[model samples]
Target chain A: MLNSYSSADKVLLAVDCIIFGFDHEGLKILLIKRDFEPEKGKWSLMGGFLRKDEVLDSAAIRILDNYTGLQDIYMEQLYTYSEINRDPVERTISVAYYALINIENHNAELTQNYHAQWFSVAQAPKLIFDHDSMVEHAIRRLRYRTSIKPVGFELLPEKFTMRQLLELYEAILSKELDKRNFISKINSLDILVKLEEKDMMSSRKGSYLYTFDKEKYDAKLLNDFVLNL
Target chain B: MLNSYSSADKVLLAVDCIIFGFDHEGLKILLIKRDFEPEKGKWSLMGGFLRKDEVLDSAAIRILDNYTGLQDIYMEQLYTYSEINRDPVERTISVAYYALINIENHNAELTQNYHAQWFSVAQAPKLIFDHDSMVEHAIRRLRYRTSIKPVGFELLPEKFTMRQLLELYEAILSKELDKRNFISKINSLDILVKLEEKDMMSSRKGSYLYTFDKEKYDAKLLNDFVLNL
Candidate 1:
């Protein structure tokens, strides 16, 4: 290779993931206690240094997989943070990715092995370095993504009740939405298919279950639609 | 410094900018012919390697200023491209930023010095490296930003006609929008202040010009609104 860029300064690159999961409780984020210095024992997003031969997307996937033992999760690159001293131990530019995974799907053993735990996004601990800001940024991105993409479905079970879907949006938006208006707005997008199945656990009169119509949802994705919440 | 991350690999980071500008002709991007080795004379986005001491945002601003002699332009980080060998000269990861500028405000002399020229995004020649992909990504982001934020105003003059605004959206969306629907949707945002001043360039009766109400626009930005183009 021609050493054309030899004069350029090189810096360490890190990939960090904000793993968002949803449950009956609310929106949650997976965090782990750092096992090594300089911020050992402190809560931080699952992260690792990017290897020379790895692409950033792969690095994020690797980091997430290493922590959760989950593969093919819905992940999107949120933003890159390069605050000069964001990583005090080195000059590191970290690319932050946000992943949406069904809360029930992660391996409990793997998570426990890494000292990883899920905390409600509203109640997550003050994280180390710039991670708190990263989480805040990721939440904002998640809320925005909820409007344009069917990403919320990634955090829900294969079959979900209307109330569950509404709760998921409310959690992601961090606010209360009128149930009627929310359902109407969501239905207007024409991405959900009402299933004959019902969940008897939530009410005396069970509520109907619905699953995202993948074909229509994908078609809507290609021709973007706005869902005013 | 602790050097706790001493074993981590270091790679060169580059900041490339897609400078979007608008005029009577339509939407355009600023491109420069590479004067350096490997891809000399090939058109590419204005870019530079990030310095060790500089933050990524500062690097983006500095690169933009260097190429256009413009400052404080509206710029946002779009995405980072790290394909291991995206740059043939080195293992360089580039953070792409999209900048919106008024076409008339750039320093023509400075641009000429760097062999920079404006090309309609639709008609621009093939760019070197992964820059073509970078431009495409930036355009997608710019469209997303347009719906949530009043960033489209950055590419327009301080005062513009309703027709000009419609044309701007059409260019960014790459589709002709219904004039009535576009006007009503924009008026509903209530972010524009119609002025007594009129531009007679396109019509004998003259078209009323409007400017963004900065306070309302900023407020709307804080409480995000959707503008479906």
Candidate 2:
């Protein structure tokens, strides 16, 4: 069945994952050592080929799992690079996907086995092919996504304080957003659930912890659009 | 040279276009009659194969030129579609692009030869191979783009009346927007040049004609964002 559906212009299909993470330090991206022919021992994003029956999203998830061993990750299709000779080995077109995951929830053993390491947004090393451009576009998109939606929640733990949320936005935008303005904007969106509990570890005045109210957020999403224009 | 880059798994690459246009009536899209086997004669978006040595944008332009004989079109790479068997004939992954062009500028003979027709958003025919979904996504993107930038000008004539401008947004959004509010929102953007001419065809009080100030718009684009939300 597969043979009958073959093509004369057979091209190689690959998936590149832009894995994003946020921690107390700031936002980061995961990179790995290739350890294979061509660009062996150099830094690169986690990637794999698309199986005959798998969708692009699944392939991105598969690649994400290979490095992090995490399921149900937040991943989005970014772009496709089809420049001939992008891969020195063949005529490969890479479909890029960006994933947002909590840094504190990753599997350390799996990442270590894959020689994976996280680098701050300002410090990721040079990558192979057009991977660097993919990362740049993903960061721009992350800034855009972070502006409208409560995407900070995606990169944070289940329960977090307003300061952590502000820091996450600061990392993504690479700018200092006014705290008063930021809190007002988040309140205007009305998507967070304020809890009675407070995170007492960070400050003398314990800041209140909030969990995302998915029900209200999804309901309000119908009338509201996230454009931090 | 090509043989040096052979791979074990080869895939098929296809190109799909989201052609947008505007006339006096409203925003329109171009659909072609599928003239080949396996859903022949069904309505489908304009499309073709990607030949070697061509950039993805170049191939999109080539396809648009073949069917419409129009050049210098406003086209952007939207997304890549890679559902296995979306195209039943082969396991083809199509890179989808969206283009905005003035409908009257295209070569009439070429358009007729391809059996293409301009259908307003309300009357487009049922399309094949997930094209309906593609068109739906393109419309949503068109709305987002028009709100954020001076893109509505692309869908109008070089000189158009204020009424035509308002109708363009209405047609794109598929909603009746309040005229006063719409005018204020547009005036705040400050991207148009109101000419000393009036269009008398629309009303007793002739409406002012405006042309897009391209030079000024481009200059302001770097630091400024134009969103109507």
Candidate 3:
């Protein structure tokens, strides 16, 4: 049965992950130092060639877990790059998946063991072989996805201050949005639960903390509504 | 050099086109009857295996031209379907692309030669090999793309009435929209040129024909604005 596809050309398939993390510094992307050649020791996305028996989604999850030691992260298939020479040694088509992980939750020991480090999106180093373009595309997708669905919360702590949410949006959009307008728009969505607790570390007068209402957020995702901030 | 990637798995790559066309009856999709083994004689999306030397974009264009004899149609890469059994015979990953063409512009001879037929989106057949899912995804993408960009114009004739435009949206969305609200929203975009001539086929009063202003539409596409109805 395998011989039936002999007349057809077969190409190597790879999955690359763009892991996005957010912290006090703003949006950051996880990068790895390539441990093998063609571009050994250079910065590139954490990736692996797909095994013959593996599905694309599983291959992506496996790659993410190998680098971050995290599971069930918010990952989405961004785009497929098929430039003939995208892989220097072969005609490989790479499907890029972007994942949003809370910076505080990733396994630090595993990250260091794999030489994975987080760099501020604005200050990311030059990446190898279309990885830079992949990162740029991921950011654009993150911005668009954040506007429609509350996926940015994946990059933040479980309980976060309004200032943190605003900063997350500002960083994703790469713009300084009006605080009042941002708050008003988010409030209108009614998918955040205000808590009595406050984050006292930021200032003498602490800011109130809030958490996402998953049920409401999930319901809102079903309807087509735009959070134009 | 190619032997270096021998250990990596190679999979058959295919391109499936969800060709969308719009006529007086509303949005339709072009489907073809498969001619070869592995689901032969079944109605399926117009597709072909990607050649080794071709990029995905060029492969999609070639497939579209082969089936419809149309050139430069507005095409977009929708998504890649990689289920292990998507193709019963092998592990073939298919990149799905959706193209919008003027229904009247396609070559009738070519379509007939290939036994291609356009079915209304609402009444499309149960296609072969996860193609039904592909069609559904294409429609969802078309709705989203039409909202943000004026790509719906590609499905309509060069000159059409406001009624035709409204019906196109209504069909793509599979719902009736308030005419007044639809017109007001579209007019606000200011990307249409109201012409002196009228399309009198639908009504005796002869509704005025309108053509899209390419420069304005292209400029508006660069901005982040939604034409929500």
Candidate topping DockQ: 1
lDDT of 3 at B140: 81
Per-residue C-alpha lDDT of model 1 across residues B1-229, encoded as one tens digit per residue: 1124778889999999888887767789899888788798899888999998899889988887787676787678999999977888778999999876778766554555566788999999999999999898888877775655545556678898898888887777777788987788788778899999999897999999999999887765332452120
Error of 1 at B84 (Å): 1.7
lDDT string for model 2 (B123-173, tens) is 888999988888888888776665555466566788987788887777767
Give the higher-DockQ candidate: 2 or 3.
3
Task: Report the Cα lDDT for residue B164, model 1.
Answer: 82
Clashing pairs in 1: none
What's the lDDT of the predicted structure labeled candidate 3?
Answer: 0.78
Which of the numbered candidates is closest to the native, going by highest lDDT? Answer: 1
Model 2 Cα lDDT, one tens digit per residue, A161-210: 99988887777777777898778777866788899999999888899998
lDDT of 3 by residue, B1-229 (tens): 1123668888999989898887767888888878778777889888887888989999998887786576777678888889888898888999998876767777554555566888888888889999999988988877766655555555677898888888877777777878987888778778899999988887999999999998887774322452110
Q: Rank the candidates by DockQ, best first.
A: 1, 3, 2
Model 3 vs. true fold: TM = 0.89
Task: Give per-residue lDDT, candidate 1, residue A215.
Answer: 84
**At residue A44, what lDDT does model 2 achieve?**
90
